[model samples]
Target: MSIWQDQHVTVVVSGGIASYKAIYLVRQLMKQGATVRVTMTAHATEFVTPLTFQTLTQQPVFSDEFTMQDPKHVGHVALADWTDLMIMVPATANLIAKVANGIADDAATTTILATTAPKYVVPAMNSHMYANPATQRNLAQLQTDGLQVLTPATGMLAEGYVGRGRMPEPDEIVDWLTQTLIDQQTDLPLHGKKVLVTAGGTREMIDPVRYISNRSSGKMGYAMATVARELGAEVTLISTPTALTQPAGVQYIEVLSAAELLTQVTAKFATTDMLVMAAAVSDYRPVKAVDQKIKKQPGQTGLTLELTETADILKQLAAQKTGQFVIGFAAETQHLLANAEKKLAEKKLDMLVANDVSQPGVGFNGDTNQVTLLTPNSTPVTTNLLSKTEIAHSVLTAAINRGA
Candidate 1:
C-alpha cells in the first residue's frame, strides 16, 4: 500500500462531523510520500480549523474563493492546475449534489470542478440521508461522470444509530485510495502483470532444535515486492521468515525451507508474468532431519552429518519457463562480476541483480545496497549505496527497459 511517492494530492474537506477525520487522511497521504494540499468548505471549518490542516501539510489551506492569498494567480485555478489527484472527504449530500451537477458555489467545489485530475469521493452523513433516492441518484451521476466514489461503511453512527454512511477510518481510506489510484493507472508497465517474488534466506533443517540459515533479513526481497506493487503488478511475495512487516496490498506466502519456497513459487509460476528470485536459498541441507532434538554425547568431541544439495530454483524455473521473464540475484563476497555473469548464463535468467555482500551496507539484512544489473551482451550497470526501495525501482526499470 506504500505507492504514493512524489504524487500531488489535493484533498477537499466538506461539512460534517466526520470533517475532522480528513486530518488523519491528509497525514496518511503525506506519510506515503505524497505532497498534499488541503481545501475546505466554510461549513467544514466550523468543525475543524483551517490552521490545523495548514500546519499538518506545511502549506496554505484554501477555504474561500473571495479570500485570495496570491494576487498573481487565481487560487482555484493554480491549485487545479497543479493537482494530480483530487479527493473529496466527508462529502456531504450538498457537496455530492453540487459536484454531480457541476455547481461551483464554494472554494471546495470550485477547485474540485476546475481540476481535471481524477476525483475520489467519500460520503458521510445520516444513514437515512444516505439511503434517500436523491443521494443515490447523485452518487450514480458521479460514477457516470467518471469520478470514483467509496461507499460509506456500515457501523455505529455519530447519532447513536447502527447503519451505513460512516466514513472509513484513516488507514482504511488510505488503503482504498492507494489501490484505486493503482487500478486507474492502466498504462503502468506492470499494470495487469502478475509478478512472483521470493525473499529472505531459506533455513535448512538439521534437527528439531537447530537449523542452517543465513544472515538475510529479507529487506531486499520485501523492498522488491513493495516496488513491484508500486509499479502496478499483482504481486505475490513468497517469503522466508524475517523480522519485517508484511507489505500491504500484496499476496504473501510464508515458507521456512528451500523446498517449501520451491513449492510455492512453482504453484504460481505458470501464471506469473515476471519472477524475481531474490531469496538467498541454502545450497545444502542435512540429508536427514532428526524428529527430536539431538543430545550431546558424553565423550564425543565431534559430530558428523550428511548433507545434500538443495534444489536449484532458478535453473529449474529457467528451464520450465514458457514466456515468463525470470530475474535472479547473485550475492557474492568476492568476484562479484565474474560470479554474477556465470550465474546469469547458467540460470538463463533474463536479468541478474548482483551485489557484493562484503561491502558495508550493501546486502543481506541492511536497508540499503549497491548492486550491478547484468544482462546478456549489455554493459553492467552498478548503483551507488541506495535504499532498497530505490534499488528495487532501478532493478525493475532495468528489466522493463530490456523488454520484461
Candidate 2:
C-alpha cells in the first residue's frame, strides 16, 4: 500500500525444520506486492528444494557460493545489490554466529556481508541453542552493528521440546516487515509530492571575465534537494553550477543566471506542490557589456558602472500561488526574525526558513546547518545544528504536517 510496492526483499533460508515456515513468508510478502527471492543453505536445501522455492517466488533460488556457470562474476554480490532488504527467516544458530562474525563461506553469509541494505534476522533453533552464551554474545554484537533481530517466539519446536526457540509465524513476520518498511518510508515524508527547489547563488556577468555573485556555495540548498528526494518528493532542482553532484532521483536543471532560473520555475510552477526559494539571486545585472574581457590600464583605478534590476522569481511564484505552498529562505546576519517575517509577507510566502549565515559551522559550504522555520501564524521553530540529512527530514516533516 506504500511506496514499497514492487520493492525487492531477499529471504535467506537456513537449516531448520522451521524452514517450512518460509513457504508462508514468501506468500505473505508476495501478497503485499514485494518481489521475493530466496537463498538456501546446503542443509536447508535438504528440507526444501531450490525448485520448490523458485516456484513459490517465481524467481530463481540461489544456494551456491561458487559457480562454474559464471567464473568471472560473483552471484552473491549481485543478489546483495538487487535486494532492498535482506531477511533471514529461520536463522540458524550457526548462521547467526557466522553473521555476527565476518564469516562468508555460504551464499547467504556472503550476500549479507556484501549487501549495503538494511538486514533483519529471524532466529529459529532449539531452546538450548537459543540460550547459548555464544549465541547471546553473537546476537548482541549483531545488534550493536545495527542489524534488526526478531526474537524467537515461545512455542513448540520440531524437536518436540521447546521453550522459546520457535520462529515467529509468517503473518506476524509480515506485519513486522510492513511496519519496518513504513518507518523507512517516513524519512521521505513528501513522497509522491512534486517540489521545485531553486538552489545556489545566481551570477550577474559584468564583463567577459568579471561577474557579480554572492558567497553562497549552494550547499544548504543542495542538501535540501537531497533530503527532499529522500523524503519521496519528485524534486526539480534549478541550480547554478556548483561542485556538487546531482542528487539521485532528482531532476536537475542547470541555470547560470536569475532570468534562466525564473524561466524554468515558471514553466513548471503549475505541476509543483511546493516551491522552496533557496537560491541567492543577484539583485541586479550590468546594464551594458563589453565585447572582450575588461583589462585595466596601469593608471586606471575605477570605472563607472550601470546596473539593471534582475527578475525576482520567488515573488512571481508567490503571486501566482494557488494551492501550492511557497517557502522562501532568508540567510541573514542581523535582525533575522524581523527580516524573515518581512520577506515572508512581502514575497506572499506561506513560510520562511531563516539562518544566520554569519555564524560559524551553521551555513554555506559546511555539511551541517541550524535554522528556524517561521510560519505566518506564530513564533518560529528553532532547530539545533544537525547534518543536512537530519535537517531535511525535519523540514519535510514540518511541511507535511502543516499540510503544505
Candidate 3:
C-alpha cells in the first residue's frame, strides 16, 4: 500500500502570491490517496476563493472560526482533532509571526494551535522578508516548537527580481512529506537496513560515437530504490545515464560502462545489508575500441569487430557474500522460468525477479511490469501486470520475508 493511503492531511493556506500553488499540492496529496482538508486565512481568500479549495477537496473549507455550521462540534477543534498531519503552504510572514507568538487570531492559526499532529511549514515571501532577522527568528521558533520546516526554493519572485523565497515546487513538497512520514515509522520492514541498488543499461563503447547498450530504461531499478527508501532503508542508487530524477533521501552515484559499475558495487558490498542487481550490464564489448569514430569504407558491405566477455558481476558478488541478502534480475526473451531458475542457482542468489521481455508492456522502458519471484525452495510467485512502483514494493516485501 502507498504511504499516503487513507492518511488524513490538513493544509493551511495563508496570504501570499504562492497560495495558488497550494492547489497543486493538495491535488497531489489526494492522488497519493490522502484525504486532504483546507484551512485558509482571510487574507489568503483574496488570492484564491474558498469555494475553489472546497470544490477541489470536496470538503468544507474552514475560513472563519466564528461561523459554526456544525452545531455538534467547534470547527477548528473538530478539524484539529481529525488531522493526522498538517502542512502550512506559502506560510506568510504574518502567519509565521502569529503561530510563533501564540496568536490564534484566525481560523487557520486557531486550528494550527489546536492540532497535535506533526506540522510542516513551507514559507513563501519576498527574498528580503525571508532573509529578515524577524522572519528568520520566527522560523527558528517554529523549529524550536517541534515543527518541520522545508527550505524554500530560490528563484524569481513575484516582486520582479530573481532571488530566494520561492515556495518549493509541488512535487518536491510531496516528496519531502512522503520521506518525513516514512522516516517516522520505526517499525517499517527495512528500517535501519542499508540497501544498494544498481540501475540502467551499462554502455560499452566501441568507438568515440558508437556504443553497445541494452533497452533497459532503469525505471524498474529506480522504482525499487524509491520503495526501499520509503520502507525506511538507507539506499544507495548506482545508476547509468537515464532521464529519471533521483529519489529523495537516497545516496546517488552515477557511472558508465560495466567496469565502473563493478568497481562501485564491490566497494560498497561489505557495508550493504541488501544488494539489488537491477542493471543490465553488457555481456560483451569490442576487443579493441578506437579512440576516434569509425568510418565506413566506400562500397563496404559490412564491418567485423572482435568481442570479449565482461565481468560476471552477479556471480562475483554472490561468491563474496557474507550476511548480505543479494537479489538478481533476469530479463529474458525465451524460457523465462527455466532460464531464471538456472541463473538463480548458478549465481547463488537469495531471490530472483524474472520477466519476459518479449511480451508487450511487460519489460524495457514501460511503466508497468509482470514479474515472477523465485527462491530456492519456495513456489515461484507470479504477479499480475502492475506499475513498477507496485512491483518494487512486492519485490522488497519478498526479500524482507526471506531475510527474516
- Top-TM-score candidate index: 3
**Candidate 2: stretches off by over 4 Å:** 1-84, 87-188
Model 3, span 1-102: residue lDDT tens: 678999999999999999999999999999989999999999999999999999999999999999996999999999999999999998999999999999
As for TM-score, the candidate ahead, 2 or 3, is 3
- Looking at model 2, residue 3 earns an lDDT score of 42
Using lDDT as the measure, which candidate wins? 3
Ten-residue stretch with the least lDDT total in model 3: 395-404
Worst 10 residues of 2 by lDDT: 179-188
Which prediction has more favorable lDDT, 2 or 3? 3
lDDT, candidate 3, residue 10? 99
lDDT against the true structure, each candidate? 0.93, 0.85, 0.95
Clashing pairs in 1: none
Give the C-alpha miss distance for residue 115 in model 3, angstroms.
0.5
- Over 1-404, each residue of candidate 1 has an lDDT whose tens digit, in order, gives 34688899999999999998999999999988999999999999999999999999999999999988999999999999999999999999999999999999988988998999888999999999999999999999999999999999999899998999999998888878877878878888889889999999999988987999998889999999988987899999999988898887899999999999999999999999999999999999999999999899899999998999999999999999899999999999999999999999998999999999999989977789999999999999999899998999999999989888
Alpha-carbon TM-score of each model against the true structure: 0.84, 0.59, 0.98
The global Cα lDDT (0 to 1) of model 2 is 0.85
